[model samples]
Target: MIALVTAALAPGIALLSYFYLRNEYESRTFTQVLRAFIIGALLVFPIMVLQYALEAESIFEAEWLHAFVGVAGLEEFFKWFLLYFAIYRFVLFQSRYDGIIYGVALSLGFASAENVMYLMALGIDSAIGRAFLPVSSHALFGVVMGYYMGCAKKSDPNNFKLWISLSLVVPIILHGVYDLILLTIHENVMFIIVPFMFFLWWFALSRTKKANEKMA
Candidate 1:
């Protein structure tokens, strides 16, 4: 009973955390955030399905390859493209914070789906750890990516591709490093990685503040 409850709630908590962090954006309304969340999830679903299908084919059978292609590669690719092509190009993403908003929304979408899968596999009790670590890290990576996008937009139109590439690279590197760390299955790298993530989160928050200040 306890395990089942944990499994179900873990995904909920992960989503809640994404929203909570995203609320750092002062200009965005709750309704807008919800809408972005929905759009992001819908956009990312196809990629998740692809990851599932590809993994099933044994092409992603290698443990290291699984982390690269199955986990980090597919997921980051989808989220990055969603924010870049779907929201950035179509929406009124004029300000830097808008980039953060879209980026985090993309992360939440990815996180929500991934959490549901883990909760089903490991159940609720084991979810406490995931909620604390992997869940938050995913969203934070999006923030980093989003920050770069905002900088690109504000800087020079010609440099947009460079910025976009960075936006994707930052998340992929963070995600790939974390996934590889966990795949080791025997190290206390979590201690190192957790603090490292905190640094990244802090840096992202500071950049958002800078953007807000610039907008002001």
Candidate 2:
């Protein structure tokens, strides 16, 4: 029973909290933000799960190429799609906060799916550690991307392309580094990743805060 609670509740809380923290913007009504978030999250979930499953099952070990590009590229592509379509295309988002809110929402969806899968595979212990770090880190990355999207949205027409391009490329590089660190966990080097991930998240959050301040 306790195990069941951990499986369900931990992922649920993590998903909720990650997005909630990113919802610091006053632009989106709760419902508008929630709507875009749910739609975008649902859109990305299956693609992420399938990619993880295929990579995990591949006979070729988790090689450098696969870990670096396949892992980062696939996830980054979907999130970029969410930014492109849900946040950018939809005239629905007027305020910059909407971008961050929706970005975090999509990330939470991916993370929630990931957490549930990890828990089911390794049981409660893995889920507990992931409950904070991996989950929150993904959301923070989304917040950064969302902040840039807002800036891009407000920028000159030609410059918008450059900002959008950077927004996608930058997150993928950061996420790729994160995957690199995890691949070495069997080497007992998990501790090295904690500080770096902390630093990365802090940097991302600062950018997000700056974006919000600019909007205000």
Candidate 3:
């Protein structure tokens, strides 16, 4: 069990550390980051309850609604809320890069808990797939979300709305499309999944660089 949890959590922590180290302008204290991460982890329960309620009512029967509205949209919104309410408004959030840092911290927190549950249910063999796909995907989604929020943070008054809107919308789209593809998985679809993941990584790294530039 210990090993199982370690396998489940390692990737998320690694990703969290990577993002944390990128904060060149202002270093956030460990306590601040830990608060965000713990809050994010706690959010998974409520999100799961809401998702279960939606599923119980047959809300997830429709593929598009399930993937887009139910899963991706709902999950991302809660994470965004955590950042907006809990972390975004904090005084430590002085630069655009700080958004990405906190955003990834929250996301990895969510991913870590989710991964543990999945690995426990599915057994250790599933760890490799979960680590690469769901865990890393959440990190990527967080990057996209944070990048826009970072833009919103640094935006002139007039541009705040646009960047804030993108902060939510872009992640929902990427996550929705990602879940939508997996929902329809078949033998030949591996081709699409690989390229899509590659694209997500590329987009995430590019945005990461841009966000880091703000610190410079």
Candidate 4:
């Protein structure tokens, strides 16, 4: 059980540390980041309940709808909402890169909790694949979300809406597409999933670089 818990949480903790350390300008307090992470981790239960309700009601009959709207939509929407309401207004959220840090904190929190619950139910043999896939993907998605949100924080009123919209919409799309690919593709799943993950890494890193550059 200890091993399972460790395996489940290690990826998210490692990823969160990596992104948190990337802040070059201002550093956020550990409390603030941990708060965001806890908030994110707590989101899992509500989302699961919602997803289960939708499934029970047969609200989404199609796989695409399930992936895009049912899964990604609910997950990203809640994260975006919390990030906006919970951490966005913090005075400590001073740097553009801070958005990335908090975003990662929130995302990995959710991912870590979800991973643990999943492994607990399914067993630890799948832990390695999950660390590389779902856990890492959540971190990347957070980067994209946080990058635009950081922009939104600093943008003029005219562009604030645009950045904020991208902050939510873009992550939903990326997450939706990711789920869609997994749901639709059965044979040789890695062939497509691997490239998509590569794209996510490239896009996320570029966003990270740009955010850092803006800070500099």
Q: Quick one: best lDDT, which candidate? A: 4
Encode model 1's per-residue lDDT on 1-216: one tens digit a residue: 655645644554455454446443445456665665676567546876787788678887677787776888777887777677766766665567667776776677666666666777877766778766776777777777777887777767898889888988877877877777777657787677777777867877776677665542
Q: Which model scores highest in TM-score?
A: 4
**Candidate 1 vs 2: which has more lDDT:** 1
TM-scores across all candidates? Answer: 0.78, 0.81, 0.95, 0.97
- The TM-score measured for candidate 3 stands at 0.95
Those runs of model 1 whose alpha carbons end farther than 4 Å from true positions after fitting are 1-26, 43-45, 60-64
Per-residue lDDT tens digits for candidate 4, residues 1-216, read 999999999999999989887777767799988998999999999999999999999999899999999999999999999999888976455767888888899999999999999999999999999999999999999999999998888657689889999999999999999999999999999999999999999999999888887532
Over the stretch 96-195, how does candidate 2's per-residue lDDT look in tens digits? 6556666777766666666665667777767657766777777777777776787688656688888788778877888878887777566656677878
Could you tell me which 10 consecutive residues in candidate 2 have the lowest summed lDDT? Answer: 4-13
Report residue 175 deviation for candidate 4 (angstroms): 0.3
TM-score for candidate 4, residues paired by index: 0.97
The clash count of every prediction, one per candidate, is 2, 0, 0, 0
Span of 10 residues, lowest total lDDT, candidate 1:
16-25
Candidate 1 TM-score to native: 0.78
By TM-score, is 1 or 4 better? 4
Question: How far out, in Å, is residue 18 in model 2?
Answer: 6.5
* Candidate 3 error regions (>4 Å): none
- Give the clashing pairs for model 3: none
Write down the lDDT of every candidate, Cα atoms only: 0.70, 0.68, 0.87, 0.92
Candidate 2 residues lying further than 4 Å off, grouped into runs, are: 1-25, 40-45, 52-62
